[model samples]
Target: MLYFEQLLVNGLMLGAVYALAAVAYTLVYGVVKLVNFAFGELFMLGAFITLSLMAPEISLLGHVVPMPGLSFHAAAPLAIAAVAALGALIDRVAYRPLRNAPRLAPLITSIAVSVLLQSLAQTVWGPGSLRFPDTPLSQIPAVHLGQVSISGSNLVVICAALVAMAGLQCFVRFSSLGRAMRAAAQDTTAACLVGIPVNRIIGLAFVLGSGCAAIAGILYAQAFEFASPTMGFTPGLKALTAAVLGGIGSVPGAAVGGLFLGIAESLCAGFLPNGAVYQDALSFILLVLLLLVRPQGILGKKEMNSHARGSLITAKARKRASMVTAPLRAMDRLFASRFFDSWTFRLLVLACSIAAGLLVQSDYWLSIMIVVLVYGMLASGLNIVVGFAGLLDLGFVAFWAVGSYFTSIVFIDVLQKQFGIDVDSVWWLLYANLILGGALAAVCGAILGYPTLRVRGDYLAIMTLGFGEIIRVVATNWVSLTNGPMGIRGIPSPSLFGYEIGDSRSLYFFALALTVVLLFCIGRVVRSFVGRAWVALREDEDAAQAMGVPGTRYKLLAYACSGFVGGVVGVFYAHFQQYISPASFSLFENILILMLIVLGGLGTMIGPFIGAAIWIVFLQLSLKVPFVNSYPESRYILLGAMLIALMLFRPSGVAAKARLRLVMEGV
Candidate 1:
């Protein structure tokens, strides 16, 4: 009973910080309807900022600074202020320009902002976890009540959370500025008509939200006595889950949800065996369950069904076929006229690419080409869902992870466990695992997709992300199966009738063949009735359903097909490396796959291939450069800048114009 009481106290303290962060998400999402992916990084920044202010002195460019340390009282406000200003700056710079753009534009931009912030933080903080200076809280002793004990820091956290939440509630309920925010959130156009500063209100929302996150960050640092660049991601993700659980737009809901999630996590960790390792996954499971049962959230009102917007290439098609650019348009028409559209040109390009791959003698270049092929395969699969079905699957790596694990378990672990065989005797198991792994992944996809039948857009994206995280957590914690992060090793490579695929050249050809097969399959699907149905669904879900298209069936098919492609790539990946690990599948990997598809041209057949080629080449070449090679994190900044630039100048991507004629002709 005493232990249980301690857990309860700890849960309440944790819940307080989560509530602050959740409120931050709810506040921004209420007005902007954008799930600021960068909010996590904002929280991380707040902690670092607070650390800087609280430290007595710090090193800068090999020079020591003699700045005096501020107490928590003074530092907290400064940290909050800095983060809040940054939030407003993010609005003015990254989001404001994309206000009228498609739903995907702002979301992608937010991810870029997140990457940029994390990279910047890493650059400044040097990627090491630092301890907070010895403050009163750390020095103060614990208080005991019978057998139950609580620390001063815990009390501080709980008290600070209550004060902050109460203050926010009062401000939002009674203040004129708060009412203006409410008005803008309800209807931006109407608020504008009523002379409310809509833009400023939106900025204020970000400010208030980021301010809350800053408080959460400081409180977290105080309670944990540590700060790190990557610390905010898990907490922020759980808080987002809480926001969704309670009712995303409801302030009260956010608090309630945070408390619920915090308590649940604590109880699970304390009571369940091996629960501590899986505690992070609990919030995601809750999020998925809530999204399935009640997507409006615990306190939010019922929302309308998600409506698909339009094809990614719709505007690009118009520009290419438009008479506004007479010479360019005429040239495009001529290119599509006769010789350019012939199979001869297409085969010629294909032959050239094949020749280049075959002739490349450098093992390093061959390895890069193999990676490009694998990424192209992943991107192609992702395109089927994000591009064709218009589903934003941030958890695409989940399928890849599942496939890899399944292959390892079947071929390596099972053999060792059951048959006492260290080496795989039957090479046919590779082919078997490919089919088995794909089928397993497809089933998993169907399971994930089924729950998300009613949810769409950003909500669906979060759920998939949670599902993905859950997979990783399970892989990390299920020690008996996955070996608990030491990772599975000694997996055998593939062979076909005695010709082994152990070398880079062989793997490159293997990957290239698989990419060709997957692309052909995807192409055939896109040109068929199912493809048209997916396109229709992407354009408008209701209209597609009204037209007798089975929305559920097509959507499920898209997911299944996507999982199959990813699974195929995964099996090859496992064999090529002859090893597997949870680290191989991460959120960043998922993001990279999506970035390639989006950067190339969503929904276009050749876009993923081109995007993968460009990305892999750029990454390889960039790493070899002297300056950038030194500061490797700088590449993320460049990628983020590229994403922002792409959104602004080429939303449909560089290949969308070329893909336009093919799509039109198919339709």
Candidate 2:
């Protein structure tokens, strides 16, 4: 009874914070219809800034600076205000311009903003999770009510949350601006026609949502007595789940969903075996199930469903977008010219590649080339799903991880360690594992695609994101199999027949051969009828299905093919590094690969290779900056900002033109 009471009290406190954050999500989602991934980063910023304000001194770029040492009451409001302004600024800078563009333009930009903010936070506050300095709120005594004991901090959090929600409700019901927001939410065009300042209202939504998220973040941090760059991601994800559970665009539903989700999580933590280890994963599982069963959510009206799959472009915006992409279109024409496909260009490229490989005696440059080719393969595989099949898979790296793990386990763990067999003698198995590992990844991809890819792009993206997180979580928690973060080390490099492909130059050559062969095969595959089917799906699924294309089968086949390529790359990656770890395969890697595809040009054969070269080369070159070298975290910030800029300026990418063949009617 005591345990239950304590858990219940704890649950209430968590629920309150979640409810507050859910309000933030619901507010912005109501107006923008975008999953502002940056909300999590805003939440992160709120906590860090509040703590910084309260601290006596803080470190900046390895320098300790004196601080004001203000109290929580004084610092929190300031932090909230600052975060609110930042949230509005972000919406203005990153989202507003792309609002009328294609659905993917803003969606991709939102993720970019999310990554940018997280990296900025990490750079400012350092990468480590920080313990908050002791405060009066954190030191507050627990008050006992019968069997249940509630801390004063928890009580404060709960009371403040209720007041915020109540005030918000009253504002929406009575206030002019609030009413305008509601009207805008219902019908933006109608509100605009009726003389409401839609942009102003949208900005206001960002401010309120940011402020609410800040309040939740600060209170949550006060409870835990810690702040971290990564702290907001889980809470933000959970809040999103809560928002979905209650019904997006419904404040009351958000509150109910948050409370229910918190209590469920708390109870699960207490009752379920190994629950603590898997606690973070539970929300993802719930989200997937909820999306599958009832995406509209409990309180969300059927008519309120606003997952717009089509372009939201207006006439003026289209003109602006076209103007921005004119340069890319020109570049596209350059690539489409006869000179590009001529033998002279091909020979020049081949000669240059060979000369560079031979002349660049330094291992570092060779290693860089190898990395570029590896990522090119990854980006190429992802292009199959996203560019060709028209499925935005945010979790493509999972297949890479799976294949790497499969070979590592088979060669090192199963063969060398367990069976007491010498791995060197059985080097031939590595070649076979490439095919087997790819096959394994193909199966996994098909399985994942079958259940999850039935939804629209946004939902499919969410599902894939969840799938990626699950794989990561499993790799992290499953200690016995995975060795749990310590990682598997000392896997052998690729041995070609008798000679080991161990040197940087040897590995470079080997990787180059594999990359060229894979890309060539991909080129061949994309020109085939299978590729045509995939492209048709990419263009319009319904039209293709109407034209006798098997949407499900073809989509699954794409997943399999892409997975096979990723798995093959994974085998190479494992061998190349001579070590395997979860660190190499992260959520960010997926974004990087996706960015490569976007950078090179979606649906272009040469785009992935070009993107890979540019990304890897520039990433390596950026290290020349002393500031970047000192603050390594800022690289991600730069990359994210570049992604945003790319989405804004070159929505179609560098290779905007393609050698598309006309399909014969009735064929």
Candidate 3:
């Protein structure tokens, strides 16, 4: 019973900080209709800024730098102010330009901003945990009530968060700007027509949200006595989930949701034997279920789901196509011809791939090509979801991971270890598992597709992201099934009829064959009615539904097909790498695949291959540069910058102006 009370106190303390962060998410999302994925990085920056202000000297960008060394009270406010300003600037730079663009444009831009911020923080802070100084707040004694005790830091966290929530509630309720924000949230065009400064109101919301997130970061730093660049990831995700659970736009509801989540997690951890291992996944699991059941949330109004139009891409194809440059327009036209869509061109590409594989004798270069081939497939699969279907799926790698793990466990753990059978003798099982694994992954993808029926835009993105994280968490913790951090090893190599694919050259050939097959299969489908339906959904889902295109069925089918491709790629990757681990399928891989499709071109068959080649080749070439090799995180900054630039100037990407073929296919 005493232990229960302690858990309750701890939960409350945790919930307070989470609620504080949730206010930031709710504030920004309510007014601007964007879930700022970079809000986590903003929260991260708050702690770093506070650390910089309080410390006398610190290592910044690999140099020892002098600091303000201010007291906590003085430094925190300044840090909050700095972060709040940054939050507004982010809105102006990363999002405002994409205001009229597709919703995916802004959402992806936010992720880029997040990547940039995290990488920058890691570079500045040296990727190591920095010890937080023992401030006056930390030095205070604990407060005891009967059998339960609460520390001074916990008290500070609770009181400060509650106070901030109250102050924000009052500000939103009574202030003129708050009324303007509410109006903007209700209808941006209407608010602007009514003479409301919609842009300024949006900026104010970001500022307030950032300030609150900073407060939460400070409170978190105090409680933990340490700061790190990656601290905000899980907390930010949980806070966003809390905001969704309560009411996206309701201030008090954020608090209630946070408390509920914190208490549930704490209790689960206390009672369940392996709950602690699964705690990080709890919020995501809850998020998926909640999105399925009540997407508007407990306190949210129906108007909160105004953007649920069945498609994340909210722009007309012709309008977007018209913005392409003259040169790119010519390229698009050249690629739109019957020759480009024909099997002859595809066969020529396949022949070229075979020639390259045979010519490249070096193992290292062949391995790189193999990676490019796999990633190309990943990009292609993702394009079907994000480009053709117009859904923002952040969890595509989960399917890939599913395929990799299934084949590995079956070949190694089940067939060999359990039955003591030789895997090489039953090489046919490999081919069989490829089909079975892909089918299983397709089923999973369709299950994930359910949220697309109800959730849209950023909400849909979060649900997909949650699914991805849940898979990662389970893979990392379920030692019995996944072998935990040690990972699965010694998987048998793939083989053909009486031939072995043991070398990199053979693997390259094998991978190239798979890539060509995938492209051919994709081409066949995209030229059919399914492809037309996807295009219709991408351009305008409601209109497609009205046209009897069966938006629900086609959307779900896209996910299944995409998953099948990802699964096939995963199966090959497991054998090629000869090992599998949770780390192999990180969120970065998903982002990288998305980047490939974005950089190449959306809604185009060959775009994924082009993007993969450019990105993977750039990565390889970067190794030759000493500075880039040393400062690895700097690459992400470049990536983020590129995404921002592309969004601002060329949201259509490098290979744009995709023309739909009424006959044998191209999108």
Q: What is the Å distance of residue 425 in model 3 from its true position?
A: 2.2
Which candidate tops TM-score?
Answer: 3
RMSD of 1: 3.3
TM-score of every candidate relative to the true structure: 0.93, 0.92, 0.94
* Candidate 2 runs further than 4 Å off: 301-330, 341-348, 658-667
Candidate 1 yields a Cα-based lDDT of: 0.82
Model 3 — TM-score against the truth? 0.94
- Say which prediction, candidate 1 or candidate 3, comes out ahead on lDDT: 3
- Tens digit of lDDT per residue, candidate 3, span 1-667? 9999999998998888888999999998888778887888888888889989999999988889999799988999999999999998988887877877755677778878988999888877878889878778887799999978999888888999999999999988899888888889879999999899888899899999999988898889888988899888888889988898887888887988887778878887888789888888888888778777888777887677544553454353223334535566687676767787677877798788888988988999999999989998999999999988888888999999999999999998998899999888888888888889889999999988877679866677778888898899899998999998788999988998757799999889888878878888988898788998888887777788888999789989999999998898889889989999999887778988997888787778878888888878877887677876888877777778878777766666677544344323332
Write model 2 residue lDDT over 211-329, tens digit each, in one string. Answer: 99998998888889899999998898788878877877888878987887888788779989988788777877776777668766778766554334332211123445677666777
Tens digits of lDDT, candidate 1, 20-111? 89999999888888888788988888888878888878653234676658987788789899999999999998888777766677778888
Q: Tell me how many residue pairs clash in candidate 2.
A: 0
